[model samples]
Target: MPKTNWKRNLYILMVCQFFVMAAMTMIIPFLPLYLQELGVTDPQSVSRWAGIIFGANFLTAFLFSPLWGKLADRHGRKLMLLRSGFGMAIVITLTGFATGPWSLLFLRLLNGSISGFIPAAITLISMTTPKERTGYALGMLQAGAVAGGICGPLFGGVLADLIGFRMVFYVTGLTILITAVAVLFFVKEDQQKKEEIVKTNTIEDFKKIVSTSPILSLFIVFFIVQCALIGINPLLSLYVQDLTTSQNVAFFAGLAMSVMGFANMSASPFLGKLSDKRGTQFVLLISLLFAAIITLPQAFVETYWQLLIFRFLLGLCLGGLLPSINSLIRHLAPEGMESRTFGYSNSFMYLGTMLGPIAGGWLTSVAGIRSLFIASSILLLINVLIVKYNVVPAMSKRNTSTSSKKKSVANL
Candidate 1:
């Protein structure tokens, strides 16, 4: 918990977070294929079950994120991380051994129930880092996660094809176990013990956050932003197929996805530093505006390359979105309530993650693939206005009040 160890902890958490995201994402691309191997051989059933299998974790995760977060606040963030990391390592490994879809779904639910590694890491880093440097630290952490997400699908698909779908699960589990071990041995968590936190009603705590300036609004902003971003993913492969006559649509689809992650990872650290210097609100507002503008053109793209370019630009804008949202959450979190605040934010986020695809599918069935992009643009634009009215003025008012206190002390 010494000052110097914060830096060490941040670095270690970044690496562990990368492995955690990669390991989890590694199994995503093979769910439906794995279903066939498990005897759900009918194409229609596979598609239905694939969507169910993909969403099962998030549904459980949405329900449990807040509970784990509350525990993080009362116990220790490190304890939560170990509980999740080790628990997931076991659950995920067992997932590989599942003989049927029912077992797979049950194990995924278990995985989601125990998961809190990223949030725990975020809370720990936020508590440890200097306020002024928090944006930079969280940004770097996000970059590591984005990098893992980008690599995970590619490696998972290849490994599934080469070794088998089952073995990939074991690899994912082993990687997560190693990540847990790294955190156990190296990461340092500085937090109040259980007795130190005032025993307050969880509902009262939630009400307090809602009444506070910008915290609740920021939570909504993050959920909407995440929704707008993820809404495109379910349709992306189909969009790529429509644009290309070549059979290498998969390659182009991968490129489109990878390039966006590349742009996001490349821009995150720089944007985080910029937000620290200028302001997170300012950076976030502009990012939302540009993200909306960039998304609009995706609907009009005539070729894969044009869509690729827009997606990359959209990624650059999004790079500024998530980390800044997270940094602001850390700044605005009340004393002894930081982890709980993040917990609620994570709940809203998991909700968005679950709903985004469903919304996209529904919209696409009604209108078209092109309409989903436009709708995503509209959501971002709506968030831009929310931040403008709901988030921005509150932050300005707080800053003015802080400056007034400083001036009064100077006069004294």
Candidate 2:
């Protein structure tokens, strides 16, 4: 196959990500409704099942993320993308055929295990882009994913009303399959020179990186951001339920979610470019503080419009977090190991996504809506503190050393 320009390849990756993310997120607004169709009518049971269904794929993804990352590093990111695309296509198509709650739950698990295309795509973009442009590239990728999150549910709800949920899955699946074929045919990886496989065990390797103050700090900050962002996720449906008793609950819930998506979709690229200019750590600090303040009012919202406004603001705050994170990882990771470092980052992110719902569900069950805002706020605060204490100090040291080196070279 002929090679494409990196920008063109990035565009392809972005389009592919849109399809993959849309397929995943579109299911969210429909799951409870779909379960109702399957005869599970107990409100409490539905809530529990909803949490399970939401988390099942995340947990599975958390488990397999590193392995996919490692594979991407060794083989090629393009192949890994193919694996994710085809795997998701098959499993998501099967999800449409699920007969009951248990079957659907199983499909979600399978779906999570199979879906790591975004990480693989991110890895590819990170590899392909110049270091100076990494933030912008990652930001664009995040925007595409968020855009899918915004539009997918709205479209999914409408499609479900028009063509049924099962057919919606089929359509989403076929769309992704087409994307997979595009990747296989059109996208190309600039293959790296072969190197001997490092003999270090995974645990020891992880310990070494974690021992690095810079990389570890990035991990902690990333975890915190994911926690804060995901904290409200599982509760969105319940929040809508609290606001209004309308039978068209799913449609409005989707609209609420899409609003956030649109905000994030609009803001991520700009934040990413800002980070590219100002540095990732500075951007991260602002991202955490911004989200914390904006997201708190979500807990107090009494009307659907108020909730929509806060959710949009929350999305805008979150828009920068992931791009800043990926940019940091790109900066700190050693040359030629971008995929491995990013894989480790993905593991932590998946961990956060998995824990967020569980924590959100538990707090909502026990302490109520206030817990969502308060807990996420606390988490974001911790993240900001970690960045201030751990990350900035180390980055300062790195910058000082680089400056000294440049001066020494000039004097020579």
Candidate 3:
């Protein structure tokens, strides 16, 4: 095989990730409002529909992501990216033309079913990059997505205010379409022949991968971390409302939400580089520990500003997590099965994403909103132990034995 231009690929994919994330988020700020415009006048109904529409995509994405991963392995990662990117563009554009809540909900479901561009991109980058550079490259890729997510809501709000909600969807669709074109033109993949590729049963393949302790631990950690991160989201605004004296509760809540994103965006690249220099497990463990610690304080904040500050700190800790986890997965994955592994990992992630809000809402109803933070903290603490005992010790033992063999070879 000829040498791959991984640097070029990474840069291009970063841009694609940014736009894709931006497109996804651009609809968020206006989703409920758009539903209202489409004839859902009852406030309670609007709220119910908003939750349903929002979650519809993730639910389907959770079910379908592994299938996409299997296909990516069989054909190519680039093809999957193109499929998702174009698929999203068309669905989002169709969403702009939706006349009722059902149509919009259906479109969101379709969108979720097709979702995998970012995961595919990650798999491609993981496959192409040199092992030593994986953490930094994945971190950079994560930063692009984070940056887009940070900017998207703000831009969506401004655009919604200026041009109205429907127009925002049109603009978002166009932006995604542009990203797909960029990928089509700029990104390249190393194609493998059918005869060279080994076929495997998807169910059996998933079982084989997760049976490994370190990788299984990482998958569980992915679920727990996502649950911890997003579990607080549904109630965050309500929590802010309780903590604040200001009349503009919406603005303050939005600010609180955005500050975390800003912090994550700023810290991701630096932490990624740090993981590269130090080690993925080192970064993952420290970040998980600190994230758990920071999360505990948010449950007790008396003022909105205090909660905001803690959320920011939590984001800083979170910056190290996904990139390090991804780097570690790449390190641990068997050759030629990288995409399938990532696909399964993403399924766990989407499952967490779907479950997080439900768990948060349930916890709030049963135990109150503050308990959500505490529960998240406990989950993350469990993850810290998982990494410490299962991931770290296993990695160290493997490294030590590998080193001993190297020394033996040198002496011989």
Candidate 4:
């Protein structure tokens, strides 16, 4: 394929990526509301149920992320994508049939256990894209995620109002099914067999990765970011209702989510590209600090629009953290191990997801909504300090290794 053609392929693959992500988020944004409708009324029960519903999917995803990556390495990325799409379709479709909170939670568990499309898509793009262009390409992929996140909640909320939450699941499932079919037919894979392929023993590989310096440290930051991001999610619908007192809360709630999405969408690429020039660690520290500063203002916001603006600002700061983490993993890991490393990365993210909402629920109950921003801000600031002095230096050492390898090749 011509060079230009390969770039076009990247774009095509990303569009598919956006669709799959939208399907994933469609169910997620409406989950807390759906649980309310399912008869979980007490504040504590609602909070716990919200965490259970969201965390269940992520717990499964975390458990399976590395395993899926190994499978992708063995069977081919396109095959992995197909698996992810089909799995999401089945599990998400089942969500619509859930009669109670427990049933919905069960489906979320199933959903996590089965799904892996985002990681699969990342793996595919990593394999196909040229080395020099990787940051740019991955940034584009991240943009698609931001777009999906931005649009999914807005579309999901509106659709839930129009068609009801159960029917929303049906639509999401069908869209994912289409993604599977699209990948099966349209997404081509490079058939060249890779050497040094290790069968995925997730626990063992997880240990190996932990032993690697900076990777573990990087994962800590990922965990923190995931916790901070999701800590607000279970409360967003409720908070919007409190702030706006609107009867049609879904539209405003969706807009609130879309604001963050739009900010992330706009900022991620620039941050990714900036990482290429200024170094990922530098970008990470700045983003973390920026996010921390912006988040504090959220605690004082009285209006929904003010909250929306602050959340958007927060998103801009957070937009680069994940991509920078990915760039660092790519920088540190051996070529064939990319899939596994990314898988473990997702697992850490899931751990955060599992913990964040649970913590958020308790905190919000005790301290109220204002505490969400305060807690997140404090954690982010701490993260920023850690990244600036600790993670960045370790990563710089790793990049030195990468630079030395490049110079050695140049000499040869």
Residue-by-residue lDDT tens digits, candidate 3, 110-217: 999998889889999988888888888998899889888878888998999999999898998899899999999888887776656666777888887877658999
**Candidate 1 lDDT over residue span 1-412, tens digit each:** 5889888988898888889998988988888889999999999999888888778888888888878877877787888889989999999999989999999989888888888788888888888899898889988898988899999998899999999999999999999999999988998776544565566776887897767789988999988977887877967999999999989877788889989999999999999999999998899999999999999999999998899899999989988998889899998988777888998989899889889998888889899899989999999999999999988899889879989999999999
lDDT of 1 at 351: 88
Off by over 4 Å in 3: 1-4, 193-198, 408-412
- Model 2 lDDT tens row, 1-412: 2234678888888887887788777776678888988878999988778888888988889887767777777788899889989989999999899899999999999888878888888888877887777888888999888877777777787899999988999998998899999999988787778788786666766776666668988887777777777767767777898898798876677788778888888988898888888887888888888887877777787888898888888888877888888888877876556677887888889888888777787788899876688788878888888888888888878879989999999999
For candidate 3, the lDDT comes to: 0.88
TM-score against native, each model: 0.97, 0.92, 0.96, 0.89
- For all predictions, the C-alpha RMSD in Å is 1.3, 2.4, 1.7, 2.8
| Candidate 4 residue spans exceeding 4 A from truth | 1-6, 29-50, 99-102, 196-200, 241-250, 404-412
Evaluate all candidate structures by whole-model CA lDDT and list the values in order. Answer: 0.88, 0.82, 0.88, 0.80
Model 4, residue 404: distance off in Å is 4.1
Clashing pairs in 2: none
> Candidate 1 versus the native: TM-score?
0.97
Instruction: Name the runs in model 1 displaced over 4 angstroms.
Output: 191-196
Q: Write the per-residue lDDT of candidate 4 for residues 1-412, one digit (tens) a residue.
A: 3456457657877787788777777766667788888887788898677866767788888888878777766677778788888988888888888899988878888888878788778777766777556666778888897797777766786899999999999999999898788777767666866677565467777777777777887888889988987888867878888889779787787777778878888888888788888887898888888988998988888898899888888778766777777777766665566677878888888889889988997899999988998999998988897898778888878778889999999999
